[model samples]
Target: MPLTDLRQYIEGLRSLGEIQEIDVPVSLDLELGAITRRCYENGAPAPLFKAFSDHPSGFRILGAPAGTSRQPGLYLSRVALSLGLPPNSSGLEIAEAMAASLDLPPVPPVVVDDAPCFENTTTGDDVDLTRLPVPLLHHGDGGRYLNTWGCIVARTPDGSWTNWSIARMMLVDSRRMSGIVAAEQHVGMVAQAWADIGKPMPFALALGVEPAIPFVCGMPLPAHVNESDRLGAFLGRAIETVRCRSVDLEAPASAEILIEGYLHLDEKVAEGPMGEFAGYVPVEPSMRRPVYRVTAMSHRNNAILPVVVAGEPVEENHTAWGIPTSAQILHDLRASGIPVTASWIPLEAALHWLVVTVPRDWRRRTGIEDSAALCQRIGKEVFTTKAGAVIPKVIVLNDDVDPTNTRELVWAFATRCHPLMGHATFEHIPAAPLLAYLRTSEKVASATGKVVYNCLPPDEWGEALPIRASFRHGYPPEIVDRVKRRWHEYGFH
Candidate 1:
């Protein structure tokens, strides 16, 4: 059955021994963020903090709702479970599942009169953002962030399209907050349209909705596509949504908390210096950005707020954004006639590097002997694609290296690829400013480029290649199979 709500998804995690309930009091300041960050780095089970030092009893915080799991056969458990796949499924399997939905007819969301999220409502003078247990995730962060894992629902001025996306927002006052909306993203584009019309864009921030909802919000779908429809396709059914109390936008019916507001064109405030998913804090100081003023607030009783401590590998950013983006790239490449068998973004690379693997048969079929030319072609196509805007590095590997396996990718790079001869640079490509390698000047420079590292042997090297000395490749197949079948006889666990 489809897990349509956050509460249901949390129960699913509990059933798998993937969640922990913390009765001890935790501070929403830096303490909550510290514990969550450590848990992510350790691959620990999701934690539910039931007690907060300053917050009321009717609210709770869930940290790392879909972080990596350490259990055997469940490395991508949280992600797999979100996509309605087995917990033991691989990254590629999860990505493919999400991608498959793109081909199916979109199941439009059904609007309802009521939702659990609207059970308790606050407006005007009664609204208090400080009552919520917003966490200061990193030491150098500017303020308590309330929207790290939240999805903002907004629509164009003409109401022709609606967009649901994840953007971080920081606490500014009891009823106001500031967030960054990149000009290139869909949400940003919609916000710009409203600005052009000289009005505040109506929006609703939906926190802790169904697991699948956030994944789609983070996905880079084509512009003007309704995220609700894609979300419905992901769940294999129509998603239930409720119109916002103060805005025209619709939010996931099961959201834990809904902050209805308007993003004003004239109002702006200094926003961020928070630790981003890139695993680094921006060197640039905070700047004035569009402010979101709360008009109405609603949430279920004892609402559970989800917080993602994004940094380094195996966090929500990697599992949610990295994996899905790789699948999107694969889909894009194949649609463009590139013979890419598989693609992956190593979590350790912080979502900046994308690896595309070419099938061995592709070379024979296409009669492509010039590895450099093929690399350039793939690089140009990828760099110009929407996925390429965020990914700064692309590695094209032969079938010998599995893109999903980081170790194999590294080996292929070290042994098969020549330093200068194998790498090609693609210039005049757009890249995310969050990349640490980019200087403040290069951050805005259009001339900044990306490198496509070719980790395949020259085509002239022929079909006969060096034999691997590993256990699976070095030994005889029959002997290896017999040893595998008699592991208990060999006294091994």
Candidate 2:
């Protein structure tokens, strides 16, 4: 059966020995975030905080549900299961499934009168933001955040297309939350359109919704494609949604917490200095961000609000958004007739660097100048478009290596790539503001331009050339199988 809620997914993780419960009281002020970040950096199990000083009865917090693991491929395995695929599904399998589902017709959402999320409602004077144990995630964080892992739902002014996305929001007061909504993201674009028409943007922030919802939210779906429908397509079933009490938007029926709000065009407030995915805090004070007015709040009894501490590697930024976005880019490239064999968004790069491997046959057929130039073209195509803005660097590799393996990638760079010979550069291509180099470097021409570091040497392009053999592929298959079959007999544990 498909996993429908966060609790079920947590149970699965527990069964795999990938989760742990902490009975000790953990403060929301920096302590919880610090512990979670340490756990992620060390490839430790997920943490469940059973006690919070201010949280309502039955409410709890879960951090890093899908994170880096010491066990090989476990990170991507958890992500695959979150998307309703088998836990052991390969990256290629996940990419193909996502691409294939694009052509499948969407299953319309089912409307329901009531849901578990609406068991309690707080609005008007009764609502108090401080009552929830929202974490001050980082040491330098400006305030408590309640929407790090939550999904926001917004529709265009015409109400034709609804966009779902993940954006960080901090609780500013009892009735207000603030956060940056970049003009490039779908949510920001839709909000811009609404603001242009002098209308308040209706929105619903759903916490602990179905796992598939947030994954679909992070995807770069085509304009006019409803993300709710995409969620349905991904899960191979209809998503049940209920209308928000104070907003026109619909949120997941299984959501643990829902905040109905309206975003006015005129209101803006400072909203950052929080720990980011790039592993650094901005030097400047927080910039003015859009202000949201909460009209109603509803949640299930003992609702668990999932927190995503965005910092260096192994956080949700890498496992949840980075890996899947890379897979979708590969899918998009292949659909557009560009042959892509595999793709990886490395954890160390903080999801900004994307490395792709394509079949050598396709390279030969295209007669590309070199892998670097090919990478530049691919980067421009992706970054100049809607999907590419979030990516800054692209590395192209031959299919002989696996992009996901950092060791194999490093080896390819060390032996095959010539620094000056393999480099390719592009100008005036759009890029996200989160890149540290772009933000701090005086040499950067503009946010949109980028440079590609091609690690392969030019001499290795010939099809007839024999390259150095590696242990994985160079071993004789029969011998390898014989060793595997006799491992127990040989007394190997």
Candidate 3:
């Protein structure tokens, strides 16, 4: 059965020994974020904190819900279980599953009258954003962030379409919070539609919803594409949603908390300097952005807030955004007639680079011998796809080098790719401004360019490829089989 909600996903984690409950007290300040960051860096189990020193009894915090796993057989266990996949599934398997689901028709979410999200509602002056134990993620962070992994639901002016997406939000006051919404994002476009009509856009912030919902929201789908349908396609069933108290948006029925608010066109507030997926906190000044004025607040009896400490690799941003983006890139490449077998966004690269692998004999099969031309074809197609907005660097690999394996990817780039001979550059393309390499001057420019690093040898040299002298390739099959069978007897474990 599909994991219906965040609580169900938590239960699934417990069953697989992937979660660790902490009865000890933890602060809602940087202490919580610090501990969470440490756990993420170490690949430790998800931390469920029962006692928030300042918050009430029912308030709970879950850290690193989708962080990568270090288990022997379940490296992507958290990502897999969140998407209703098996615990032992590989990264490639998960990406392929999501890519295949993109072809399935999106099943719209079912609207219901009553839901746990509406169990407790606060309207009018009673609304208070400070009531929740929002965490101060990093020392350099601007303020307490209320939404990291939460999904923000918004719609077009005529209600023709709805978009669900994840963005970071910081607490401003008891009645208002502010967040960064890029103009290119779906939510930003929807908000702009409302602003063009001279009105505040109604939005609902849903936290701890069904696990698959957040994963889908992080995807960069094309404009007018309903995220609900894509999420339905992911789970192979329609999701149940409940109407917001003060907004036109609908949130996951089983969501732990919901903050209904409006994006005021005239009202702006400073929001930023938070640790981003780029692995560095931007030193730029906080800018005036849309202020989310809280109109209503709702939550379950004993609600839990899921927090994603964004920094380094393997965090929710890397796992949720990077993985699905890779799948989208793969699909786009194949559709554009590029012979891509698999693709990946290495966590260590911090979501800036993408690795795609193709069969070594692809040139022979397609009769395309000009390596530079093939590289340009791939660069133009991928850099123009939906996933291209966030990815700045592309690395093409041969089939022998698995894109999913960081070591193999490094080896291929180090040994096969020549700096001048195998590289292609595309200029005047859109680039994500948050990338640390894009300085103030480059960001101000109309467009930024990207490089396509081809880490594959020339087609003519394929047959003369040097043999890999690794244990598996160098040793006899019988000897390797015997060693594997007696691995435990040899006291290796």
Tens-digit lDDT string for candidate 3 (226-334): 9899988888789999888887778888789999989885788888888999888778878787899989999987788999999988799999999989888887888
* Prediction 1 global C-alpha lDDT: 0.84
lDDT of each: 0.84, 0.78, 0.85
Alpha carbon deviation, residue 418, candidate 3 (Å): 0.6
Once superposed on the true structure, which residue ranges of model 2 sit more than 4 Å away at CA? 54-58, 71-73, 367-373, 440-446, 456-461, 483-493
* Cα lDDT over the full model 2: 0.78
Model 2 lDDT tens row, 1-493: 7888888888877776678798878888888998888888887888888896544456788888667666665656667768878777766677667767877889878988999988999987777766667888888888788998888989998888888888899899988999878776788888889899988799999999877777788777767788889778878899989998988888888788999888875798888878888887767687788899998998888888888888877678876677667767877777766788776777677877888777767666666756656766676666666666677787777788877777887787677666667566777676677777675442133365666666544646454435558555767888778888899999998
CA lDDT, candidate 2, residue 307:
86
What's the distance in Å from true for residue 62, model 3?
Answer: 0.5
* Worst lDDT 10-window in candidate 3: 458-467
Pairs that collide, model 3? none
How would the candidate models be sorted by lDDT, starting from the highest? 3, 1, 2
Task: Give the Å error, residue 55, model 2.
Answer: 5.0
In candidate 3 the C-alpha lDDT for residue 113 amounts to: 90
Runs in model 3 deviating more than 4 A are 365-367, 444-446, 462-464, 475-482, 486-491
- For model 1, residues 336-437, the per-residue Cα lDDT tens digits are 777887878887788888888887566675566777877887888777866677888888877666677778778787887788776779776777777768
